[model samples]
Target: MAVQSAPEKALETVGPPSAVEEGEDARVRKKKGTLQDRQDMWRIGREQELNRNFRFLSVLGFTAVLMCTWEAVMFGSQYGLLDGGAAGMIYTYIGAIVGFSAVILSMAEMASMAPTSGGQYHWVSEFAPPSCQKFLSYITGWVCVLGWHTGIAGCSYTVANMLIGILAINYPDSYVPQGWHGTLFVMAVASVAFIFNTFLAQKLPLIEGIILIVHCFGFFAILIPLWVLAPTSPPSKVFGSIEDRGGWGNNGLACLVGLVAPIYALIGPDSAVHMAEEIKDASRVLPLGMVWTLILNGTTGFVMLITYAFCLGDIDKLLEIETGFPFIQVFLNATNSVGAATGMTVIIMILQFCAAISNVATTSRQLYAFARDNGLPFSSFLAHVNPRYTVPLNALCTSLVIVCLLSLINIGSAVAFNAIMSLGVAALLSSYIISTCCLRLKRWRGEPLPPARWSLGRWSAAVETFAILFLLVVYVFSFFPLTRRVDAETMNWSVVIFSGVVLFALSYYFLYARKVYSGPVTRVKQLM
Candidate 1:
């Protein structure tokens, strides 16, 4: 159960260096002077053994549900993920839940075999043939990072928006914003979460557990009130046929357009696998967490949406809010008391914070893991560990900084921030698609799958193939602006996904990947 130290100890003990070799040896070893003496390397083994009491399984499920708990129940039901401004996204969410649900089933199996810090990138490296490993893993890392960052930034601003909504409901004329006000609030909230994560990644599982309890229990907080205020709707209206939106011409296609909105809610469910090195018994805990997390989220989110729709009966009225946050309007009407609506707003804000916290853990650890493997730009420095905390302190701090900078974008344009957040979902879903396709390809090639605690067995290939198609379909839709409106403003999400790739490639070929960075490094390199 003990992990071995870094592999550089061999070079350290060499006799006072007088003999020096030049060429190839110098490229891998950085120290100035003396011949690059022969260094011993350790074969890969299960070394980053984390503490293991089934912690991840207990926490991860709740993390996923807490994120969408508010969104699905309050918003999706009214708009049906419609794609109209924020209101229409109700339909988009339904599609995402269905799509991601398929993808996670596939990923849960993959997680058992290659549970590590690298996640999609590492899994691709191990399962892929040597020739394609480098390129595929690199692409996956970029996509994954984009997705994680989007999820984090989305959570931060979503939290801010929720807080602002709370302010509006509580105080008259609290519209306060030169745009910078919301930005400042977003940054402050994000900073607080960032600081907490940097200081407390180790305790995240426990914090997530507490959040989970509130996340699930908080549904009743609203459900109880809405049920009392408005009991029932015509069954036909609630679940019968798709209500008309626009341009769709048919309800069937409108459903397709709706998929783009909720894609993010279904993301980060498997994020626990990114922290495979941190979870104890990750092979077991992580997989269970990934699967059950979806189950918990899917069930609650579905029930919550149905209940809200049954109670809400009026889509037109819900969409009539002056601020365009229909969920707030729902509270204002449902309670008829601004004070009670303010209380519900507080609950929603708590949920947003919980989402941010979950992402901080998953995202920072994944970045740390990728860097540990020499896949990121300052990998050597980023892969460092704080011996006292036994945490990837450097990498965590770097991730915090990156997200903090991303928060500023909110100041200039919430639309831009929302668009980037959308693009991130595309990139993320793309990574999942690629990862699942890898699984399908391996089966076709008759490659032997690694043994793991959780797997889909006979259904594995089919499940993965289904997931790939699901994500591909949803990702394709991401390019279209909802409301049939295309500008720099809305659903520009796909643009950033493309931009993130172009940006990463530019740097990879010219800067880091070529000059200082290389391939598949380990903590072993740092030991030197």
Candidate 2:
């Protein structure tokens, strides 16, 4: 062999880059370019405070677990059974999926336009008329915040109830479930979310990735046994039966009330959108995360709904189960083993707790974003990002406080707590409706929108219109009492709660925020 100089030897040792390596290098460069492009488009300065630690799969996992659709469908099946019965769940679920598709697609396109932790409020700022941008954006921010807070409470309640449900199943004779017991569990559940979101923040993406497996595996784990071991209803009963157990007096009204179950199961696909600032190539990846989560969760949730409907045994008996959870009875009936049902229920409880963790993460980021814009009462404090963990510790704490307070309502009355939970869905839908209307108005006026990497093309007009209209319809129905003979326990207080928040936001705006606060759009250098 010929003698070689030091430089020549080093080159030979390193070797040339392969095609695969070069391709990957190009992709990485493209990703950086996209991120920079998005930042420049948004024209905001504080993008670096939170870490971009999430990628596509992790984000998808975060949203999938956050939605926990199939599990929610089961948890919420009783209301559907009471009004719409087996066939009603099947049909309304189908309709809700179709209607919600428009809302998700519309929101997805806007997310691509401005992927930020502010979510609907951010979009409202960008898309609304300049004259009303400040007011609309501020109101949207508050409503969005209200929505997420209620969402945290709702998730914690689910975990708490499931835990108590397990205890009631195993120790029925001794465990006379007290309302305070569930409240204590709710506190514990909220604490878990706060700890993970604040202390283990770095591990969230990895945790979510792993939990995604459990999400799917648990689906099959509970599903296979139900299909194999449970008694099945005939096709006619499963597909065509409808009941008006709520005494709504008409099949149409009963079905409408039942639609709440499916809609609630599907509402939070935007969980990924609220984490946009913490995702690589967020403008593109965020929309994909939201869309795919919805598709996957919807498909699986629908399948599970059909399965549970068929295996429901006796609806009245399941409803009367001391655990206060119909799904526990379904699992028990299917497996015919207390241990087996406990195991399956534990999987659901675990995933729900996981969802609560993700909920806290998203809710904190959202509150932090609004506070950064001086939209909240304690704007500076709530916006603080912990220097050590690079997480919004203060925001997380605030969310925890609100969650605990909301859960405290459970001790007063389960019906009241449910009403608070229902407010979450209504508030979120209101935010959607406002943002979609703003986008549609801007489009009609021929104004330039922020360039969208994931545009809906010509379908944008039709999709946005349908989203607004469908959302409005759902919002109206969401406030109606399940039965016409409305009483304190049976009445839907969502509208009251929603109106109160809006009134508070409006009052606070004129009283304080209006003087110091501007919409997020005003912070955009390019727009200015």
Best prediction by lDDT: 2
lDDT of 1 by residue, 167-194 (tens): 6666657555356656667667667777
lDDT of each candidate versus the true structure: 0.62, 0.83
Over 4 Å off in model 1, which ranges? 1-57, 70-81, 84-98, 241-250, 410-414, 491-494, 510-528
Displacement of the residue 11 alpha carbon in candidate 2, Å? 43
The list of candidate 2 runs beyond 4 A from truth reads 1-38, 45-47, 412-414
Candidate 1: count of backbone clashes, pairs at least 3 residues apart or interchain: 21
Decoy 1 TM-score against native: 0.83
How large is the C-alpha RMSD of every model relative to the true structure?
8.6, 9.3
TM-score of 2: 0.92
The digit string of per-residue lDDT tens for model 2 on 427-453 reads: 898899999999999999998887788
TM-score for each of the candidates: 0.83, 0.92
**Residue 357's C-alpha lDDT in candidate 1?**
70
